[model samples]
Structure formats: C-alpha cells, structure tokens
Target: MGVAAPAASATPTDVAPDAVAAPPGDNLALTPPMGFNNWNSTHCRPEFNEEMVRGIADLFVESGLKDAGYEYVNLDDCWALPERDENGKLVPDPERFPSGLDALGDYIHSKGLKFGIYTSAGTKTCNPAGFPGALGHEVSDAQQFADWGVDYLKYDNCNNQGVDAVERYTAMRDALAATGRDIVYSICEWGQNQPWTWAQDVGHLWRTTGDITDTWDSVMSIFKRNVELAEYAGPGHWNDPDMLEVGNGGMTDTEYRSHFSLWAMMAAPLLIGSDLRVASEETFDILGNTEVIAVDQDPLGRQGTVVSSENGAWVLSKEMADGSRAVALFNESDTAQHVGTTAEAVGLPAADAYEMRDLWEHESYQTAGTISATVPAHGIEVFRVSPDGDWAQYPSAVEVGASAVQSEAGTTAELTTAVTNLGRTPAKSVSVDVAGPEGWTIEAGSATTSPALATDAALTTDWTVEIPPGTPGGSYDLTVTADYRSPRHQPRQDSLTVEAQVLVPPGEGTSYVSDLAFVREANGQGPVERDTNVGSVAAGDGTPITIEGTVFDKGLGTHAPSTVEIYTAGRCDVFSAQVGIDDAAGAGGGPPQRGSVTFEVWADGTRVAATGVLNGTAPAQPLTADVSGASFVELVVTDGGNGKNSDHADWADATVSCTA
Candidate 1:
C-alpha cells in the first residue's frame, strides 16, 4: 500500500542529498495507528518479559481492544542485549525473550495482531543500561527487522552523536525500503527539529513533543504543543503527541477522559501505554469508546483546529466525512465553566436546527444554533454535530457553576451557585438542591425554585454549608443538582460538583513539612517521597537526600509538575526550604546529566516566592515565603520550559512556622 514516489529533490543536505520529497511510499498508517506499547507502565522493569507481552496480546482479544481498531502490539526500550553479535546483528535479550523475536512475532501474527520493534538513531538507546542502537547499522538492522516479520518500527532519537535529524532519519527510511517489506516508519525526534515540515514523506508519524508522564501538566503541555501543527498531518502521516496514559494512576478518571478526548479530537494516535492485564473497568470503558475512536480513524483524516480559547476554556472543531463537525468543549480550569460555540462558527452550513450526538454520553440532542456545555474542571464534552441528521426538538440547555468556599473546622461558610438556561425555549418548575458529605450540614439561604426561566436567564442561590467539629483538614466535594421541565414538559436535570477546602491550623511554633500529612499531592514521575531523594522511575526506590555534597534529613522529594498542599488555617507565617535538583540524576550516569526544574511557593493560590531554572549542576538555594493568614500553603515544582527528562527535584529541610 505504498504511495507513488515523487521526483527526486535537489535539496543538498546530509546523507540523502537527493531524498524524495514524499513519505516512504508504504501506504501504512493512513490514519493515526492505534495499538499498545509496553513503555509507560512497565519501562525496562522485570515484569516486561515475553510472558507479559503474550498476556497483553491475549487481553487485547478478550478485552475488545482488538475489535476497537488497535492493531499493533509494540515493545519499547530494553528488549535487546547491550551489544550486538559478531555478525553485527541486534540480539534479543535471552532472559527476557527466551523464544526470540521471530517466534514472538509469529505468535502475535497468529492472533491477528501486528508486531513492532524499537531502536534509536544514535549509538545507544535512552535507558541508563545503554542498549545497542541502529545509528550506523541501519542496513543490517532494517534487514534483521524485516526477516523477523516486523510490521512497524519506532525509530527513536537518543545519543545520536549530534547527527543531522533529516540525514539520520532518511538513512533508515531508505534502508527499510531496500528490504522490500512494507513497514510503518515512526519518527521519534521529540519535535526538537520541527520534523513535521519535512517528514511528510519520510515517516508515517512523527512525535511532536517529549515523552509524556501520567500527570495533568504533562498532558496539557503536550496537547498545547501538538495542537498547533494540524496543517502538517494528513492521510498517510500523523502528529503523534506520545502514547496514551489512560489507565495510569497519576491522574483522575476525569483528567484521563480529557486526555483521551483531546487526543482523539487532534487525530493523534491511540496507542495504549498502560498494562491491560490489571486494568480497571473504567479504563476499558474509556479506551473502548467506538464513537470517539471513529472520529480518530475517520477516513477524511482531517485534524481538528482550535476555534476559540479564553480563560482556560477551549472550543475545537474537526471536519467529518459526512459533512458533520466533531466539536469538543474542554475546561482546563479548577472550577466548572461553560464553554460554547455556534454551528456556523464551526464551518457548518446553515440550517433551522442541528443534530448533536454526545460522543462521551452517547446521547442525541437538537440545538437551535448553540452547542455548549458546563464542563467540569479538567474535563471534556465532545459532540458530533450535523445539520442533515435526524433532528429532535431543542431542549433547555441548563448550565451550573459554583464559587469555591473555604472554612475552618467546626465553622460555617457560604457557597453561591448559579444556574443558567442557554437554550431558545423556556424551562418550567426549575428547582435547585445541594448535597454535602456525611456529617456536614447544607441549608438553602435563598429561593430554590422559580415558575419559569426564560432564555439567557439565570437563577442564583446561596447555601450555608457547615463543617463538622474535629473534622480532618482536606478537600471535600459539594454536589448541586438542578431539575426542570422542558417546553414539551419532559423532565430534565443537570448537576454541578465543586470542591471546598477545610483548614485545621497547626500548633504554634515550627514543624517539619515532611512530618505532616498533606491535604493533596501529585508528582510527575513517581509517588512523592519523604526524607529521601527522588529515586528511579519506580516508587520507594529513593536514596538519602544529597545535593551539592550536602545531605538533609527531612524534606520532600518529587518530580516536575509536583504539588504538595498543607493545611495552615490562617496561622502559618513563614515557610522555608532548600531547593534544587537531586544529585542522583547525575550520579552513575552514562549520558550527560539532564534535568531542569523551577521551585515555587503558593499561599492561598498566590505565588509568594519562586526560583529560576535549576539543573543538576547547580547547588541548593534557600527559599522562604510569607504565608500569614493563609488557609493552605502549596509547594510546587515545574519543568523548566524544557522536557521532563531527569527533573528530580528536592525540597530539603522544609518547614512552616505558625503563630498561636
């Protein structure tokens, strides 16, 4: 299924000066490739063996993933020995793949699945163990992969010895062609060189960003970077923003849904990066959404474009094959927000009404002209809208939003909620209700019902919420519901949920933050550590905290995009720490030490103090912030505008001082 070759180009550059200006004609990956890769969940771990791979293949068939358009089952790094054989051929790790690559490939083929292998364009792979790469051995390695029945190849860019990106990638493209096998070539250059401009005919898909961690910041950052490159993707090639971290435990189900929704909206590849054997039902439900998958695999292969974005609310639209528009309303803020767009704004033909199908909810609704939703924080709502489909009567589009409230234990606080009707028709008998957690009291302070709500009209209610005495300090949810009757007298309802923070002031004097249980914590790489250094990629593998030959006994060790929120209850006055990148990133290193991070302190959502970008080569710097009369203090670490390669950050001797 190769594309027709174009005339040879005269652009003189590196290795392939006469390289054709079209993709490798193998017509693979017409749409973004959907499959599984064993890297994010089990990276070079002992559990990533042949038995595990075989079990994944079985689960794909049993879990309906095979039927969901997932075709490739790929292996990442650490599947091979450190060195090649005397014949200069790559050798599979005997202990990991005792049956060898040929047998494993055959087993995968028998199950109606394709096999994929990985290699770097540099001299060695990215792992610290440094496995053999195919930089100078492209010919022999390509033949080896072809002989082993490989259907796909993910050529990575690590330790490339500063070779030209196009030259290095073009060598492998030509080498693969010489073997006479139709293999999908994936360019993993990490988007450092803007491969999208020239990779149209060189590879099937190109990574537009760095490696993705199972964190919200990582996901959002990658999405922002790749969303702007829609013009570079088409039928045969794609813009891959790395693999899917759907089943990973770092993010919530809502955030994971947003992750999947945005990726599908952008027409990115749907490669599963989590362990399927122990996956939860929610994970399977998110991955097996065929309606969403259809948009990704749509034959038109048009990537969605951002129509409008403001204040963390985004609206995107993708042109479908049947003259429909797949629209997404994404809310990136911490509170529920209303995101809206018109049919004409999405380039759809004018009509009396448009039929909208909720891709996530699998429900159908008719809209006069407005397509909108009250999207939850870090959540997404996707719809497939067409003007020529079965249209039903337009119903009331009620949206709900709430203001956040903070209260001390054993005290009462006021929360305000607003309900708005955005539809053309009016709603009758509209009533509101609020519910709190067990042992908490909720009372309505204003009128909770109205006879009729007209279009663009809003109703507000104030609720008195009480926190129980002696309740632990943390975050809790308040669920608000609105019930109304449509113009046709049909019962309709909508719900809004928001978080409330409760404060439990610490005792007067100084206390080490490591000794306190945080209200919430999130890390980019692994679980946040206490009194130790940010260790390897796995949890509980940390060593003693050491930075610039200095050791600390009490502190927090975490990765980039990390947050640790501690209760202060308007009593804390000072917070201090010695912050820097952990020395372990540079210790026992094969490649150059690579890590960059910035430290920040937030008091009641306000950044009080911060540090510039710090790498492993810099020494620890003292940090202090004034957090007086603040309910909580947030310690944050962010990736320093670069990739999160080795951003192991440490907050040593972290302490907070409180007044009596």
Candidate 2:
C-alpha cells in the first residue's frame, strides 16, 4: 500500500498571535549564517559525542575557519534524552554529554564562537530513537535553552501532530523572545508549507527544500529549487537550501568546488555539514576561499538571479555593494562547454572596459564587455566584474584553451590551442610557443604568429607532439605560451597547460581490463579497486569481487558517480563486462539493501551501453559495447534516483578485445 500524506494542520488561534506580527528585531543573521552542523556526516552515530564537538571548535580556530567568518558550532538531533525530567524540561544525554549542554556552550564561547542547538517543533525528534521535542512545552524548552547559553536554535519539523507550521514556529519565536536572549531562529519545515512566503517576519532563516544528500544530482536538484526564490531573500532573512556536503565522500573535488561556488552565489547559509576532524587539505582550501565568502556576506544582501540557462549552461549574476557583479558560468553537461555572457547582460552599466577577477584562480584581467570561460563538466567559473579604465597598465584579457589528443606510443598527435582576445584593446606581434617533456618532439604548425589581433578575435595554433615509444599508458601535460604586446607597447605573456593521453592497447587477443592502467579515474567514496569489491570505507580494504553470490576473479569495483578511462588507442573492437551492485553492499553492517546505481560505457565521449538503475537485490547483468576505432573507453556508474548511501558497483569479468 502507498504511504499516507501529512494531514492538514488545525489552525491554533491562541498561540503567539504577536509572533507573526513582525520578524525578530534582533538583527541576527544579517547575512546567511556561516558555521558547521554535525548531522550529515554523523547522523545518529556514536561518534557524535562531547569530545568530538569540542574538537570541531578547536579545528575552527586552528584551521583559520574562525578568522574566515565562521561563527556558530551547532549540534543536530540525538543530543537529548528519550524523555523530559519531572519538571517537564528536556535533559541532555548524560552518557554522551556528561558535563551537560551549558558547559559545552561555554567552551565554544571561550573560542569566540557561538553555540547552536537543535530541537523539533513536534512531540518527538526525527531520529528513530524518538527524543523529546518542544511541542506544547515550547515555553519551558526555550527558557531552558536560553539558560544553557544557546545562541542559535534550529527548530525542526517531525511528528508535528497536525499543527499548523505558522502556529508551531510562532510559539517558539515568542517563547525565545520571552527568555530575553538574542537567539537566532532557524525554521526547518522542509518547505512543505511554502515558508518563504511568510517566514520573513517569523525567523532568521527558513529551509526551502528537504535534506540535501552528498551527490551531484542532489546538489543540482536543490539548486534548481532554491535558485528560483531570489525575491524572498535579503538582509536578516534567508532562504536556506539545507546544509552543505562539500567534504563528504559522495562527489569529486571538482563537483564539490561547484557545490561551494553555487551556494555562495545563491547567498544561502554556509553551515558546513562534514566531519572537519578528518577533512582533507583540499576540503579546507574550498571552504576557506575568502573571495567567495565575501560575496555571500555582502552587506547589500541581494540574492543572485539567473540571467540565462540553455543546453545545460547557466549564467547567474549578483550585484555587490561596491557596484560590482558576481557572475557564475555553470556547466551541467557531461562534457566541457564554452559558456559566456556580456557585462551588460548581467546588469552592469556600459563601459569601455571592465576588470574581471576569476574567483577560483585569483587572477584579474581586463575585458571589453564579455565574461566567459570554458567550464568543465559539472564545474563553475565565478568572476567579479567591475568597471575600470586601466587597460594600458594590464594586458588584454586573453582566454586560452586546448583540446585533448589521443595517440598511441611512437605515434604523432595534433594539439590545437585557441587564444582569444577578450579586451577592448588590440594585441600586437602575437606568437605561440609549444613545450613538452624531455626526449619528446614538439613542433609548431604553420602560421604561429600574427602581426596584430583585433578585439574579440581568436588565433588558433596547432602543434604536433610525438609520444616516446615504451611510454606508459597515462596522461601527459603539454604547456602552451602566448606572447604579445599590449596597446601601450608593453610585453605581455599568457600561458595554458593541457593534458594528452597515450593509449596502450592490449595484445592480439582479449584480455582482462583489471590488468591495464587507467588513464583517468574519479570515484565517489574511495579509490577504484581492481579485482576486488569496493572497500569497506577506505582504499585497499575490499574483498574479492562478488555480486549476488557470484564471484569474479578478474574485474573492478568502484562507487557511484565514478569514471575509469582505459586507453584503447582505436585498436580495440569490443568491450564486455557483467555489472551489478556488489553483494558486500547489502551484507555490511552499514545501511543494508540501500545500494542502487546505474552502469554505463562510453567510447570516445559517446555512450555505447547502459543499464537502468539496479539495486542490491538484482542479479548480474551482461553488457557489451562495440568500441571499434575508439581511442578510449570509459566505465561509468551513477547513483540511482535516491541518494548515494551504499552504492558499491562491480564490473565483473571486464574484458576488451584488440588487434595487434
């Protein structure tokens, strides 16, 4: 039978009529709150203890997060006991928090950080353990929270018992005011009641979507929902799209960078939702980008609006307090795309030239009017554009990009680099130079120099690079440098680096793909495994490849949203594999029977084979693809419609047939 929907709530007229009259005048969250929340990475796990909480505060101070404007260190559910005390007051779990909540709050405050706590507006919290919530006991619970020195309150919606959202949320707002403490109020109703329409006068921030999962599809879905509500967000009030999942193990660093950039562009709350205790250096770099954070915390408090979206390319622009515009060129497709927009298009006034600063690269270039970039698949390029007249001092904005080349060992490949002038001024004596590794031949094609290049014009230069014989099958980097003179006759130079892959086909017969080295790989959870099932939680910690009780001696194991590119050198004719969710995914003590993924094979950037979404219970399915004359074959797996929880996928008996 189908599940029932939430019943309509009965309006409570007598509850906090003054609460809905106007928003709290405390001026909290003038910008979206920036901090960390311990729910996405830990859930209700045993590691969510007092010691871990204190460690997070320490990391915030030592890791420069505190200096970067991250203030609150909050706790989610499972911190309270199953029931209230004799006086009907919520109590902290003694075993988990022996020193109690007030002491912990003091420790966080000692570090110059604020303390935030969570409780539901319903009778019970969201977890299956069913902790006490603040339904009719709002007055006492708010007072207890105030006495505990809480600076922020994340009031959730679970077991709401058919009470109106406005009434339940308003009751807490009034009760919090009664405590006379300046507590920031966050409403977590999951947008079921369209909170943005009326939440401006009720709370500091309101969630506009359900919980976010750590996956690419989940990020895109939430962005699509929240990006449309720009009008409702401003100073002291924000439309939340749930916590961030940047450092979680469900997406690549590129995808995580896009996630962070998009959230900053949307001006959403920057509450981190990862375990900072074990976060990697790359994670810290992404979260510590001050330029991006400055855009989110801009006092002007204008949410970015979409200027255009077509063919998986999106352009969003936000006006800053200093009369600058933050433009984001986002690519949602599966391949690299060139996305561009004009300064006038992003609401900037007409000017002779503008300074476009690449937020990710931390470089500034002068552009006549265009703001553009060759965005990678599922990536973003953010630029802060402002009117300027320093064209003579700076070189013309030149964009350089190159196409990947596929060639076998001892073979010659052609690589083309396109240099475009994006500024209002002209470039003179433009010349291109190509460089490669030692013992490798690099020669430029005909017409490597131009006397003069006009604005908005492009100069394409091709170079033939030879791969040394016996070179291993992998990716190699080639650097291209473009030299020119600015309008003021000053010497200028811009350089770009690109990758080229050398394909190593198998011998005259069919061979197992596990024996070959991949040219590129990206996994969701951990590193891709060869001849074994995906690891339990770390690299090289997996068992033999097994799917539905069938063991494969020669195959590969990996997580969803993974891609493993094997070099075929256009000599391979066919590729075959038996693909399915690894049986270990369901057997582990982790969330059982929750594994779901899709398997696909792509030859030379074109999909050749696919299997619809498969769960843990499905048997192994045979897949074959005709990869004739294809230089590379990519084995890809994506999470099912649901979030990525236990998506351990296997490619059993994976083999490729090639000719000598």
Candidate 3:
C-alpha cells in the first residue's frame, strides 16, 4: 500500500553530488507533520528495534491517528551498528538488525506508510555507536539512505565540536540532493545557534530545543520559548520544538492540555514521543483537539506573538483565516493576578464590535472594544475572534453577566455591548441597551448597528459607554439588555460587576515585588498557592507575621483587604501587627513613607493570630521581624494594590538555609 512514487527524475544510481538537479518547483509537501517517534517508549533503545517499529506502525493505524493526521513512524537514534567499514561505507548492524533495512522498509511500506531513519550531523551518531556519522561522510551516508528506501532522514547533532553546524547541514542537503529519491530531511540541532533562520533552506523542520521531558515545567518552558517563532513555519519548512511527551505520565492531564495547546499554536512538528501501544484517553483527547489543531494547520502559516510580559503575566495572539484572531492569556505569577487585554494589544481592530470565542472551554463571548479575563495563578485562557454581523455579538445574556472589569479613579473606562449573527444567514435589525452604576454614564455611540454583521457568520457589534469622570471609585455594576431577531423575540438583560479603584500616583508609595512561582500540587490534588516574597530584615529583628494590601471604599463607608498571607520556615506562631500609610511625610509632602507592620509567621501550615488597623490617614513603618535558627521567611499581601486603605505592601527580605 505504499504511495506510488511520483515519476522519479533521471534515476542515475551513481550520480555525483554536483550532478544532482533540483525539482522544478518546491518539492516539500507536508506541514507541521503529525507523526510518532520511538524515543519515549524505546528510551532511544528499543528492545526489538525492527519489530517495535512495525508494532508502532500497526498502532498508528489501530489508534486512528493516521486518519486524525499522524502518519510517519520515525525511528530515532541507536538503531545502527557500532561502526562503519574502513572504506567509509555505512551499514546497519548485522547482529542487531539482521534482516537489514530493505526488509524493514518493505514491512513498513506494506502497511501503506513511509519509513524514516536517524543519524547525526556530528562525527558520531547520537549514540556514539551508530553506523554512519554525518560529518565528512555526508554525501556517502545520504546516498546510502536513499538506496535503502528511506523517505525521511532525522539528522541529529551529537558530539558536534568545531565544524560549523550550518556548513555541515548544507553538506548533507547537497548530499541528499545527490540521491534520486525525494527524502524529507529533518535537522535536530536543539535550536542552539538560532538554526531556525536557515532551517527552511536546508531541511523540512528544525528542532528548536532540547528533548522535552515528561514534566509540565519542561513542556511549558519550551512552549513559552518557542511560540514566538510561529511566523517562521510554513508549507515546506517548519519550526520543530522537539518531539511531544503527551502520554508519558510525569504531568497531570491539565498540563497535557496546555502542552497540546502550545504545540498546535507554534505549528511545531507533532512527533509524539510516547508509548503508542498504551496511550490514555486523555492522550487521545489531546491529539484530537480539532479546534486547536486547526490553528496549527491554518493555511496562513502565521504564528502567535507575545505582546505583553508585565507583572508575571503574558499574552499571545494570532490572526485566523476567517478574518478573526486567536489569543492566549497566561498568568505566570505565584498568586492569581486579575488580567485583561485590549484590542490594540492583539493587533485587532478597535472598532466597537467583535465576536470572541474561548478555545479552551469552546464557548463564545462578546466585548465592547477590549477583551479581558481573570487569569488564575499558572493558568491560561485561549480565545478565537470573529467580526460582527447579525448574530448576537456577545455571550449568552446569562454568560455575559459574569464578565469582570477593573479601573482606577479618574480613569474613564468604556465597555461595549452588541449582538451579532453566528449563523450562515443574515438577520433583521438588532440592538442592545447598556446600563451602568448611577455615577457611570452610557455615552453616545455606545450602541452600534451593523448590516455587515449579517454577512460573515463570525461578525459582532459592541455597546460602548464609559464610567463617569471623577465618579466615586469601587466595584461598579454594569448591565446589558440585548434585543436580537431570535425566535424568542424578547429583550434579555445581563449584569457584571468589576473591582474599580483610584490609586495614589506612582513614586508616592512603596514598590511591589514577588517571588518565583512554582507548582506545589501532586497527583489528583490541584496546585496550591505559595507566596515566597523576601525582603531584607536585620539579623535579630522579630519578623511581623501580618499581611496587608490596598483597599477601596465600596461607597458603603467600608473598605475590604485585597488579599493577606504570611510565610516563614520557623516555629514562631503567635503574631500581631498594624497596617497604615507611612505618612511621617504628611499630606502634600510628597508620597507617604513606607506603610509597614510586624507579625510572626510559622513554618507549619498553621494560622497566625494577628490583628492590625489599616488606616488610610498617615504613613506607617516597614514590617519588621526577628528570630534565631530561622533560614527562610517572607511577608505576603494577597490583595492587589487598589486604593487608599494601605500603601503598596513591602516585604523585608530574609535569608534561608540550603539544607533540604
């Protein structure tokens, strides 16, 4: 069942390197190839090399991966013999591969699939005991690969010393040209030396990073580093972020979903490196996420780009085929950080209307001009955008009621509401009414009427209105009433409440700092929050165990703390502290002195009994602490700096011991 070879051009079995000719147009065909590699299950050392390759071939079909897009069954390094012949001839190891490659090739072809082999561009193969080294023998090795019916060549980079990788790669490119076969050349340089810039000219896809471990951190770190290169991948050439480790079990299902979401976004080669014989249900779901897969395989070939990286948060977005865009917001902070995105941040039109879809949850939403969402600690949200037409432009009246927004005093914020056509056909006139808090105002043009919204199934319209200037600040409640041409033919109303606060101008308060965020959950339990903010405290000062953050008056004559927490590695339990602005400088004297307090934090997961008054009146002192034999400690504020009750909380740094 092997695919019929396109008429071979001048099958000159012994042609010289320069004598080879290039195909008329582009010869590369596949894009972001979906395939299976043998390293994960085999650990680069399969017990039954030939048999396992065939078994995986069988699984590829049985698992329905071939129909779902996975096709190639690639054998990684370690399949070759210990050495090449003295005459510089490369051959498969007889003892390990007794039937030789021709029979193996036949076995694979009989199943209606292609065959691929592994080699290295350095002096030795990846395992140091493989047949042909790719260095000076590039031509000979490549020609041998062609003669063995090899359809793909995975050229690794191991033991590569001084030889320029680019030059060595071009040498193999030339050598592969000498062979009459149209082989897919894959470069495995681990993304070092920025191989992506030239990968298109030399191979099908270039590995962008080291081998990805079966851990969430490894997968996430790799995805973050590589998603920006989405623009570099295209039809013939692709940016490979190394093989996938989906089913390999070092991470949870949530992490695996994140892994697939990223790879699909980056358009990296989906060469899975897991045990295909026993893939889990979750693995199938990951490999079969059609919405995400569609983004990777989109014809435009454009990759997602990072727009912002502030306050432990990041946003990535990509333009889609239907004239819409997809976006992903990441909260990389230790504690949950409320975050949002404007149309400008994602290169979308600032027009008053647009339709947005949350890809992870597979739900549609609506926004005025800006799209925003709350990002949980270490969590992410992906979105798809479409223009407005006649369909309801926003989420269901019920769903829209859950939207959140935040604003500072004197900052006028606008929220749009609309309904667009999500159906293939156009609809009659549609409209919506928006209402805000008493002090807020629904400005003119807050409601939009678009006939074009009836054309594209993805079109939407926005209801634009702003919060009143100098309005008393606090979480404001907004409501929208939608009148669409639906069968119900009735107006539906929804409401949302967002935290709003006016902050004291910058340079007038203490600065904020944070610690490295780490995953603290295991197994079926979800990840927990751990605040490790450290500040310098004198050697003998007792550490304050109370936490504080800014708060805003809710117009009810009361203010609430944003968030509060404390951390320490010692047994100091009972604690107390007070919170207030360090107003020793007095009002109009410039920003207040540091607002601080004192409290003791314990090492055990025990609570601290402490009380303090957070008065917005005057500045307070920095939180202080004291103890002996204590190695690590930290003060934490769970609340985001919103308003007057407290100046930005400051943590006095402390030292810790390295003993585990």
Candidate with the greatest TM-score versus the true structure: 1
Error of 3 at 104 (Å): 3.3
- Tens-digit lDDT string for candidate 1 (1-660): 001112122322322323425655567888889999999999999999999999988988998999999989999999999999999999999999999999999999999999999998888888878899898999999999999999999988888777788888899999999999888898998877777778878899999887887878789889999999887777788999999999978788999999999999999999999999989999999999999999999989999999999999999999999999999999987666879999999999998777788898887666667888888888999999889954647565677778887778899999998877755567788899989899999999998999888766778999999999998877888898999887764798888887887866678899999888677777777778999987755667899888777889989999887889898878889999999988887733323447889999999999999999888877889999999998889999998988677788999999999888
**What digit string (tens of lDDT, one per residue) describes model 2 on residues 1-660?**
001225328432432323444555788899999999999899989999899999999999999999999999999999999988898989999888999999999999999999999998888888877898799999999999999999999989888889888889989999999999999999998877888777777899999887887867678878999999887888888989899998988888988999998999999999989999999999999999999999999998989999999999999999999999999999987556778999999999998899888898887778899888777778898999999556456667777767777788899999887778888788788888888778789887867888888889888888888999988777777787889887765688877666677877777779899899787777766678999988754678889988878889989999887899898877899999999988788833434566999999999999999999888888899999999999889999988878666788999999999998
TM-score of candidate 3 versus the correct structure, residues matched by position = 0.59
Write down the TM-score for model 2.
0.84
Cα-based lDDT for every prediction:
0.86, 0.86, 0.55
Over the stretch 346-445, how does candidate 3's per-residue lDDT look in tens digits? 8876565566777766666555445555554556667776655643544431222222344445555545443434332344345455667676655534
Question: Residue 501 lDDT in model 2?
Answer: 74
| Candidate 1 clashes between residue pairs 3 or more apart in a chain or in different chains | 1-27, 2-25, 2-27, 3-25, 22-201, 23-201
lDDT of 1 at 642: 87
Provide the TM-score for each candidate, comma-separated: 0.87, 0.84, 0.59
Clashes of each: 6, 0, 50
What does the lDDT read for residue 302 in candidate 2?
A: 88
Give the lDDT ranking, best first.
2, 1, 3
